[model samples]
Target: MKRLAALGWPALGVVTLVLLWVGAALYMGKPHVLPGPWAVAETMFSMRGPLVVAAAKSLSRVGVGWLAAAAVALPAGWAMGAVPALDRELRALLSLLRPIPPFVWLPLLLLWVGIGEPSSWMVCFVAALFPILAHARQGVAETPVALAAAAENLGATGLHLWARVRVPAALPLTFTGLKAGWSLAWMSVVAAELVGADGGLGQLILDSRNLARPDLAMSGMAVLGAVAAVTGGLLGWAERRVAE
Candidate 1:
């Protein structure tokens, strides 16, 4: 009942949005320009086979890239947080790199890695790496110093100190990083794939546009949005679990 109440306003907002969309579609008086919801639904059902395949391809790319980013970032960030000297040396470099948009590196990545899976993966990696590293480093560095001291006093040493004290203490912020990184990776993967992909949501959108099928492009956008929503929800659930 409480959950229903909480969702009421959002449901109302969605209805309001739909009404506006319908009004716009009707007023413009051209189905080709902007199809109504029903038209989009009809189009979607008719092309469900190809749409599903494109969605799966994009999602697989995102998964591969995000997992790679996580594996690299967590250990590196943990190390930077654990050692003050390393942080001092690396902080300047990180600050320099963080502000540059990941897509800016797309050209160089293409040049170096060529237009293939490697290039797509590189874009996602670049998009995800900085956020994860920043968050993980912050999380580990901010673990209560007093608690760490107490652990040390209790004869916790090296890996034992990290395992017993640091990792658990830092998990919430690390989870935050993971979520941010995943979202970034998802978006970047699509953008990268747009230029070079033979099959994926990005390619679907690009191809639809090239074929002058705006409705199909819109459908592809909807599918991508749905995938992001589901992925984000799962990440949120994971965050809650770790925080708890």
Candidate 2:
């Protein structure tokens, strides 16, 4: 009951949004220009097959890229935090690279590798990498000095100490980075797909515009929004579990 009550405000907001949308769509009476919610819903249902396939492809790309980023970032970030010399060495380089958008690499990557999964994966990897890496380093570096001293006094050493003390202490911030990376991965995948994807939600939206089907484009947007909602819910649940 409390959970349902907690969700009530958000549900009301959605309802309000839909109501306003219906009103605007009705007043405009231009289905081709700005489709009503029902029209987009109909398009979503009618184009379910293609939508599913596109969503799946994009999701797979995100999964691969995010996982790859986590694999590299977790270890590298830990090392940077563990070793002051390493952090000093990489800090300047990281600052230089982080500001360059993932899409900047797309053209060069496309020219080199051709448009496909490789390009998409690379874009997603680049997008997801920085935050996870930065946050992980911060998390470990910020672990209490007293905690480390205590652990040392208890005869904890090396990787075992890291595993028991630093990892747990770092998890909250690390998870924050993971969630941020995951979100960025989705955004990057869409951008990557818009240019080179044979099939993806981004391509679907682009095609809808070219075909003059606003409803279809809106349907694609709705699907992406649904994905965001689902991702947020799952990430939130996982965060709570770790916190517990």
In candidate 2, which residue pairs clash? none
Q: RMSD for each model, in Å, please?
A: 1.3, 1.3
Candidate 1 clash pair list? none
Off by over 4 Å in 2: 1-5
The lDDT of each candidate is 0.88, 0.91
lDDT of 2 by residue, 136-181 (tens): 9999999999999999999999988998999999999999999999
- Best by the lDDT measure: 2
- Model 2 CA RMSD to the hidden true structure, in angstroms: 1.3
